[model samples]
Target chain A: MNTPFSPERAAELGDAERRGSAAQLAATSGLPDTSSEAWRYSPVSDLNLDELRVVTGAPPAPPDAPQYVTEAIDSLQAAATVSVIDGFVVAVELADGWVAKGLSVESAAVKLAEPEEGPNLFDHLHAAFAPDGLVIKVPAEVEITDPIVIRSHLSEGAAGFTALKVHASAGSRVTVFEYQSSESGGLVVPMTQFHVEQAAKVNHVVIQDLATDSWQVGRVTSRVEEHATLSSAMIAFGGKYARIRTDSDLAGRGATGELVGAYFCDGDQIIDYRTFQQHIAPDTLSDLLFKGTVDDESGSVYTGMIHIHPDGAGSNAFQTNRNIKLGDEAWAWSVPNLEIENNEVRCSHASTVSPVDPDQRFYLHSRGVPPAVADRLIVAGFFEEALRRVSIPAAAQIARTLIAEKLDVRLEQP
Target chain B: MSELIVDQLAVKVGGSQILSGVSLTVPGGEVHAVMGPNGAGKSTLSNAIMGRSGYEVTGGTITMDGQDMLALDTFERAQAGLFYVMQAPTEVPGVSMFDMLTASLSAQGTASTDLAATLSAEAAAIGFDVALLERSLNVDLSGGEKKRSETIQMSVLAPKVAIIDELDSGLDVDGLRTVAQRVEKLTNDGLGVLVITHFPRLLHELNADRVHVLAQGKIVTSGGPELAIELEQTGYGAYVEEETPEPKSGGLDDLFSM
Candidate 1:
């Protein structure tokens, strides 16, 4: 946990990678400005980057995961699996001649996603101090329906930045499941980009079950081409402060994008989500649904924007976010916005912040269910809708199990 | 055999006196019917027994079998063998009918290994839509369907005593007959029943051994089932005058109640 981001580690990078990191570091002075609309109401301003030792040395050996994690992976039976500890790719296993590669500094620098908007502080830091990661590239005209799984984990008292890229060629189909777990006092920043070519189908589900004391700030930028579809879901249950910004840019005509974010927080943990559904072409469609629950003193924030460009005529976009607060002191904030520059487009947004319904609780109790079990049943049932929306069946099953496990803990204390 | 006895029950709800001096008895294996007009404390009696919030039992002893029910919570009373068929059953979203039955049966410690098949058969018997077994419990269900769901629950759980409050409100002739048959079937198995209804239509199908007139929070008169037939013609105008005007809930006054 020493100064792994020191000048000695900086000297390890090649000339081009070093120059790219230097440019990013010089352009961004500090953390992303919280006053900006993109960072409004976020907790990143409270993050102490100096307190974290950004890893740039040889990554440590991956630790033995807890039984639950291994059980989840065993249930998946994924076609290909990759493990990245800290920032280094430690293991990769493929079946049926799958396609994947260990990412290098050169490839990581090239795959880095820098939008028209300037890169923020964490984004800059990721570019400056990232190590070897993983890349999944599906060949054209091929169909790999089985998921290509990736496990990214970080050790205690250190920060990890894993750069990952996924490219689905034309007429190809694939699925990716990325699961992240970290130790206490860990800071994890993962940058991912997906290029879904024309007429392709790509699905990605990310389950963030980090330790309750860890912090994570990540981003996913995906682009869908003509006649293609991109479906993404994120299930977050742990972390002191976790935030993920997801942007699905429909850049081709007749492209479609579906996104879902489901999370539950307890005991002062904060979960934040920011999403952008960018309809850049005509005849595009995008739908987003985010549902979450906050208990104890925890809170959450969900702010989504649907932008339909002028050329996006005949586009249809919808955004809905709902959150339930279980504790008297818990809070949730939902803000949805629509920016339409086309006359023929249709767009709608909805959000709500409510508590566990008393009438629902009473009905369950009157049926012989205990008060604590009644609450657990209501909350478990509440997430069924969001979990069913997960495009991957296996991921949905694991998410459901994780949710039940958490509820079981509640049952024990109750 | 089970018995439900209520002695001099007094109740208040949301700063309004809903029931006072209400007393009734339902012995094992018998069906007793209570007929009353709107806001005459029929629903209040059932609500107070079920321990609904906002309904305070100022004074009463609700005993089931032999234990004091007032000392137990709603679920404890339910697990102790009591069920109430509400007039307006609550719609619990995200909880499917199957899940509700599973949790209830499990909590009751009587979950048969083949619950799916038993529930399917019981739903068919109670005239509940079998296809609705997959949907959220009572959510978006029609009034009759909600009533059928409640009846299905009663049939599945097979509690020792059941208090039916206006179960015939939204049922058609066929639905009413099927529900009555289910209730009668349970009653024959030593289940005591206390049914409250506004119309004689349900009694025509249900076999009630005794009938009582509950007006103004008190049971004014009790007689054989013939009283239900006679009251169908004469109404509560006869016994209502002899009883004091307790004014439990005036017609317009109930509308403003919480």
Candidate 2:
């Protein structure tokens, strides 16, 4: 058993009902090990559960707003901004127009009462520790023109857990930008669930820029109904061990899902990603592209699988993952898998791990670009393909700036 | 003298001699054409001068404005006022043509903003489309467009010495004429040029000051503009002899022994 949950501690946290269910589940199942397929190529064995303490009670007041958060809000012109500090929702602002249009934010208990698909130790741990969560819901057929921004910051030595559920009604449209950032050592587990109804369109982007000593394990699970479209882009550039697992389900015919991610890590950091694209209905389509770069002693791991069930005949899927290793010590592992149960389906997967192209470097050098500057340009251009697919101008710009800053540091290195 | 000089240059590629004891010179303000047969090592010389890897210069003294170029890296050579138009320009997916041109110009201490205006004006003057400037470097461009884009890059950098290898290979009639006009314009503006081509039309259009015929890794002939016309009419067959008959499978020793 993990750790016995004290009922008195749950009462002190003021969420005994939710914590009870999480305790029951945690008592039954333990953390995943390297032998588990989902945890392969990850640093799961290195995680120390004893060092983590459950954060409870009222969330401390947030510190002064950081520059990046302010800049992202201004650039995106967000309709509603929600701030979470130390595992609790500190503040939320819903624009007057959005409020009139039936957009609402509410505090709720963790809803993972029973084990559903893709349940893990982190989910139960979050439910047991997190006191409250923020839910953003859009009404049927309504469209929110401006994005909703959720910004999270974890203080030093604080192990924070937070949950977010986004529900878009049939024929509705919404875009959300989640920015996770910190400057000190900590642990943060954030789980986000999306329910995209029939004919609805949703765009979600997660940008992670944490401190070098921080660790994050994030999970994003979404279900798409008939004719609905789901697009997600993950841009990560921080953390000692930052990982995101995305599970996208196309449950109805004609549903479409697109996933793209770009990440860069330096120092001794590690960025890991595992994604599942499940096509359960006929004629559904899914496409994924992930590109990343690692410099110094940093490394990255990407493993994704596209599964087309028997009912998924006439479906189409494509997955591509490309990585660049900048230094001799830098490493990358990319594995793309495809599973098809029907003959009429069309699926393709490609992966590559290499250093920067020498021919490209020579081409730039012949044109008077110095070696270091040439590398910076090539790395920036490497991410441009996915950056252009972001569809959100402000989010794309934010990603571009972060990547450029990282390259700048690389150039300044001895 | 401020001239691009190649003195007794010998180059090897992968342990095979490609350019042997080749010597030539193109002084400032003159256009020189190196006309040769298909295997005449014209491209090898350009690669050797630009310090492309795998093209080893065993013996050579390549100098521009009295500065030794063989010792410099490719980018350093460019900084020393040497530019090359490659036969097959690489496609860089994310870097735009404008970005490359600006970066090159900035290396020469010119502000990118100021150079952008000049580049736009030059593009207009040369009849090149300005929309291509926004595209990734050499990506998804037509053959002729890639050549013209290289020319545009040349106009932006304004290097003192430029080596253009087979600039007319992928060009149409109009493209050839436009490129010839640009070459003449740049030459008249006092930029020395060395043109390597199989056809004489571009050299004739540029009013080349000299023409050198390279055969078997060496320059066997040099002349004025009339040589280009002569080579165009006679082809390279007259200068190159057929391979000598095989050794007769050691017939002389067999006959003597018998």
Candidate 3:
């Protein structure tokens, strides 16, 4: 058995209350068994929880800037930049006029409390080991034109856990762009929470390009209140096994949420995504679209659910997931389900797994395009449908570059 | 000797014969029309010449400028300056017509600045709406619009040898006249053209140099442009046999001969 929870570790990390709660969770709920429905088709069984140790104190000096971070810094003229090294907040910089306008960023410890609903093993583990949390608050009536960027770089053989909380008051609007990269093999777990108040709007984008030997498990949960809008996009391109779970709760009437994602996995990589669209109030709307392509021996999994309660009458929800298989050994699994107890709601879900259309290829070939070039153009067009919906120009460009790199590798093969 | 030639060609699809020992030629600076009843292997001949898949050439020779085209892939033949305007253009989602035209022109070594100017000029000359360029290729387009877009593509490609298959089927009177005038102009400019049609109006307008009548997978007759007018007046029944009986043998002799 593992050593008992230490009071010293608690004092160095957070309060004793958080430590007790995390200890109780760790003792009661162990890692999920492979027989569980949610864990099926996932590589969680191969993970060893005991191998990861709690990290404390200051992290090593910040390493050289990663390629993705440099590219993002060059492309986005951000209003502020936050650098996180090994889950430690190293620096936070805001533009000149930002402090006077009621925008603040601070370091705080997150309370190790279980979610009211849908508590998982990873959430408990993250609560037990999180180093420090970052809190970003935007006051009422403050609108920021430039995006705030967050960059995370994980070093070799390190296990890091981090939490971030974003609060947008009524009538406020902000955009956040997060870029995560790694130098070598490691495990990174992160959790994010968003509270969008009444009539507020938020745009969030996450771009992950980790090393091939690394593993990432992340969670993004948001609550959109009355008349608020939330637009989120996720572009995932790297990692050995990268998985993210998103939960969007429309808590009040007239709220809207949109989720879009584009991912390309090659070689032996695996990208898994799970999304939950919860409509609890009347007259709310949620739409989701995810498109990805897998080549070589890679695989992808997408499972989404649209839940509409009885009070969620007059709500509209849509979910779509499409995947293209470029190699004979590549595989994709998509499962979209709807749970509706309401009588007067509109809900639809569609999922497709297919190879490239022969007619499209023939059409291109008849126009003098080579086979490899034709596939490249088709794949680019496939991702463009979702990328065009992204609001940030720099984020979209970065995603396009990653996708082109994957296509180039495939083209070079005999 | 620089011409598109098909000599005693035979083709099959899915283990069934389609074209049997058909011969035709279209020299430079001339127009030739192939008139036939439905299912006489007219489209098959065009498709075979373009090297489209599934049109297996059992015994044939297709050459342009004395280079064997049957040994090349579709894109290779296209790179060799062969073009074909299909009967039913395919609609590709998420790909714009302007992008396709640019890619085609760039494949032939056209510069970017020249591509835009040339495309605009060609579209205007063909009476095609410039707005169609922004829309997805052939998606949500009417039959007449699709034919017009094909004409624009042909003009942009400027191929050395062009095969126009059933260009008059979905066209209106004005569209037919426009296409005929375009083909006439191309032929006048020394581009070899093979025009396949069922109606005689396009041939009359084109002032075709030769007309070939195809029946039962073979050319039954060949003559000047008047042949099209004569066949239009009387149907193809005169050239096709009414009936032919199956041969029979005596049972004892057939068995003993073996």
Candidate number of the best lDDT? 2
Worst 10 residues of 3 chain A by lDDT: A1-10
* Candidate 1 lDDT, B1-258, residue by residue in tens: 788999999999888887888888899789998887666788888888888888899987999878999999899888998988988888776788788878888887777788778778988887777999888888889888998989888887788999998877777778888888888889999889889886655677888888878887888888888888886665666656554543432233422331
* Fraction of true A-B contacts recovered by candidate 2: 0.71
Minimal lDDT window, size 10, model 2 chain A = A2-11
* DockQ comparisons of all candidates to the true complex: 0.59, 0.62, 0.39
Give every collision pair in model 3: none
Pairs that collide in candidate 2 are: none
- 1 or 2, greater by lDDT: 2
Q: Report the Cα interface RMSD of each model, rounded to 1 decimal.
A: 1.2, 1.0, 1.7
List the candidate 1 regions with Cα displacement exceeding 4 Å. A1-8, A16-28, A97-110, B127-135, B140-144, B213-223, B230-258
Model 3 RMSD vs true structure: 7.4
Better of 1 and 3 by TM-score: 1
The DockQ score of candidate 3 comes to 0.39
In model 1, pairs of residues that clash are none
Which lDDT value does model 2 have at B222?
98
Cα lDDT for residue A206, candidate 3 = 85
